[model samples]
Target: MTRDRQYSFRKVTLDDLPLLAAWQSAPHVRQWWESAEPYSAADLADPKAARWIVSTAGRPFAFMQDYTVHGWEDHHFAGLPKGSRGIDQYIGDPEMTGRGHGPAFISARMNALFEAGAPVIATDPHPENALAIAVYKKLGFEPAGPPEMTQWGLILPMLARR
Candidate 1:
């Protein structure tokens, strides 16, 4: 299927560090991310993580990462399909919030992950993030279980299958 023309994804690069740091520090992003440190080369070099900058008409606005569930021990998806992958994303540009980009770009990326051999995909959003839960449901992701505590905090587990 053709990706929606509204957005694109490109592997994040060192050149994007400053931009990414600025975005990470934005009030909207920081609220959920709960991080104050700027991103570093080491963070970007995580071998198990596929990181990308989500853009719209060539303007960057979001960050996304996908990793194999097995790569993270004790992760929520450990018992699912062997090739299961998990996704984490945030729209760094506050102005872009409330737009349709969340579901559009996520759906596009999820398709790519499936094509790359992921039989299942999961995402754990903060349990109170109603907007994110709604978008995931709209994209056909169903609740896998109740909210669970994780190193990051409490998340509502959700899953999608190919």
Candidate 2:
């Protein structure tokens, strides 16, 4: 975590799907993600969601997405304060993991969201996903509730408030 990292998030486009698809199929990402399928037309067009290609020093290395917490019905984070948002991400390049990039990029995006007036930011990692939980905690997220079954599957809800 000592090395300085400069991260950037660029909006995802259709052309990036092949790269994202490859990442989604990686063993590390597949271990916890529900589906490895790249974005469908509907997903890409969803007005409430934002998908991004995460990069460091101009090299694309990860995928990320965020959305309005209450944008969907039955959403786990809907109970959060109005203007809250939710985030999910993965480092596509195997070499990028365990090197502090997760916290660095997530913090950058989270801070941007907060500065843009979001009241809270939420995340839900599978209960067994210790790596993700650790990263979230490192980024100031606290467990908001116990595990719950949502459309996304079982998750341990966590939150960080601005």
Candidate 3:
């Protein structure tokens, strides 16, 4: 698909569930995604979960999930200032891997969140997810703290005036 036709960051909807579920279960794709349990159509249809489908040319390719950090209250990071937001994403299609879509999708999502008044965004990945860590760093996300036993913490650089 042409770069111009890619849907880097679009809100996900119920209609895209079937495609999303398939991608999530793909062997290659499942390695990085934590949700391995069966996901029902009703789960996707639920509005309480704020998620987005990343795609190109109107075809769904990945999933992006975000929520208020305070609401989940997970103690993944201790040094980050309070009021930070968390962002998580996974490329649903294994065939699309290593084709240069991750960074573009992340940039688009970050821009959208920043514009929406989010001062900070955070993502945690297993240390072995080197490819994803590389992509995160390439997108200007700096390591926030030392890597925990299983996960590494990363934070996007604060917006700076040009």
Candidate 4:
């Protein structure tokens, strides 16, 4: 999808910890993310995940990450092909919520992965997250299957093939 606002991503670093913690704690974010605990250095150090701080014109506003689904411990994405990448993200700024930035940022990230030769990319949002599901569908993601309860939450699997 085309976006009037141009956005980019930067590799998430230690310097972003405070902002990450704050965003994770925001009521708007926590409502769905449900994480009250702060992100430890170890979380960002995860080898299977590539984390990024999404920005527009060099100003940070969101957090996003993509990880090899198969590399995750007992991931629900076993049905997906090997080399499949899964994404998770949140708009850190409350003011940015409801804007089209989510889809734009996701599109940019997915395009990067496709350019890098990834076979496919996927995302799992809570089944009840209609807003997220809608945005993902608008970006060409289709439901892979019904919702399943996992340690993270009840998720509706979706995939976008390159």
Question: Per-residue lDDT tens digits of candidate 2, residues 34-131?
Answer: 78889987898997889999999889998889999899887988888889999999999999988888888899999999999999999999999999
Which 10-residue window of candidate 2 scores lowest in summed lDDT?
A: 1-10
Q: For this target, which candidate reaches the highest TM-score against the unseen true structure?
A: 2
Worst 10 residues of 3 by lDDT: 153-162
Residue 144 in model 2: lDDT: 88
C-alpha RMSD for every candidate: 2.2, 1.1, 4.4, 1.6
Clash count per candidate: 0, 0, 0, 0
Instruction: Please state the error at residue 63 of candidate 4 in Å.
Output: 0.3
Clashing pairs in 1: none
User: Is candidate 1 or 4 superior in TM-score?
Assistant: 4
- Candidate 1 global CA lDDT score: 0.86
What TM-score would you give candidate 4 relative to the actual structure?
0.92
TM-score of each: 0.91, 0.96, 0.76, 0.92
lDDT of 4 at 26: 91
**Residue lDDT tens for model 3, 1-162:** 235645656666666667777877888777767666544667655543467888786667778876555554454643345545567788877777777777788777777777777677777776677887888777777776666653333333221110
Among these predictions, the greatest lDDT belongs to 2
> How many Å off is the CA of 146 in candidate 1?
0.8
Single out the weakest 10-residue window by summed lDDT for candidate 1. Answer: 1-10
Task: Look at candidate 3 and give me any clashing residue pairs.
Answer: none
